[model samples]
Target: MADHAAARTTRSMTVPLVAFVAGAVVAVLLGVLGRVHDPTLSGTTDLGFRTVIEMKVVLATVIGALVVLQLLSALWLYGHLGRRPPSWLGTAHRVSGGLALLLTVFVGYSCLWALGLEVGTLPHGEPVPLRAVVHGVLGCAVFGAVVVKIVAVRARRAPGWFLPVAGGLLFTLLLVVVLTSAAWYVAARGWPGPAGY
Candidate 1:
């Protein structure tokens, strides 16, 4: 019985551990690639915005809201907040999560395709802004974390505690991403529509 229990425990950990390694490798490779590649500057088709940055900002903002909804819904679904989750709550959680992931991919692609990694000083020799550096690191980390979370979530036999932890990590990473990028842009530029539009 003890032997069986030990084997089960080991098996349970195998998937998550593999996932962690994969995530780490992906993050490193992406950062390396971003450093080597020259940005297109033209950006992945701006989707209808005047510029890629504008489109990226808008998509990121929407994804931020969806992420917020995902966190709340997950909490509610797990009975971490309030009463029992409604029947439709599961659907809402899944939909919001899917949408957030989808939009995140778009913003990430735009960043990589157009801007690449944030490094070096400006033309005037001013250092790259600290927020940009932070945002760039977190942006790379996001995809890795998301992969781990998704893998953990799908692993039915994994430890019960892993899903929540993975979700929370992803949540925190995304919140910082939004704050440093979209929120920072809006804060610095005083909202896109007010002046730009």
Candidate 2:
């Protein structure tokens, strides 16, 4: 019984540790690549902005912070589950969750905005309707998910399951957002725009 309990504890810790390490590695690699290549954007405007790489850096930082906060909150919640923690732990969990949600929304918006501007919907070049539409839809979905999470947490009807379920969903969404954004970045760089400018 004791060994089983210990194993469960170890397994719980494994998820958070993996999240943290993965976030750190992605952040470092993206940051280094951004510095080395320093790609430019040129289309409707003859101006250059390292927009994609910058977006990656911003997303990485936000996601990294979110992962750390989520891990901390998870650990606290684990303790509370075993034996009720102090009032402050509960408050901390709420605060951390709120921040994570906020950051996730920001990442989503920034990604869509970057995509729109780069693809020429605004004033740059011929617009790629498909990419724009996909980005916009994903951004809205992320926002909607955050709203649902907020409502669930505040209701406090079934916190034990609610929190974990929400966290898992948000984590999955973050991964998708990261992967898609990375894919779009690569595609943008590979294909030349109006001026290649």
* Top candidate (TM-score): 1
Q: What is the C-alpha RMSD of each candidate to the true structure, in Å?
A: 1.9, 14.2
Per-residue CA lDDT of model 2 for 1-197, tens digit only, reads: 99998887666555444444554454444334333442334321212334445555455456656666676667666774466666787677667666766666555444434343233353456675765445444444455445444544554333255556656665555555554555565556553333334
Span of 10 residues, lowest total lDDT, candidate 2: 38-47
Name the lDDT value of residue 41 in candidate 2. Answer: 41
lDDT of each: 0.85, 0.52
Off by over 4 Å in 2: 1-49, 80-92, 114-138, 158-160, 182-197
What are the per-residue Cα lDDT tens digits for candidate 1 across 1-197? 99999999999998888888898888887788777788896637877677788777888889889988998899899889979999999988988898899888888878877878877775489998888888888898999998999998799988988888889888999999999988999888855562246
List the candidates' TM-scores in order.
0.92, 0.46
lDDT of 2 at 12: 58
**Where is model 1 more than 4 Å wrong at Cα?**
120-125, 194-197
Check candidate 2 and list the clashing pairs: 42-197, 44-124
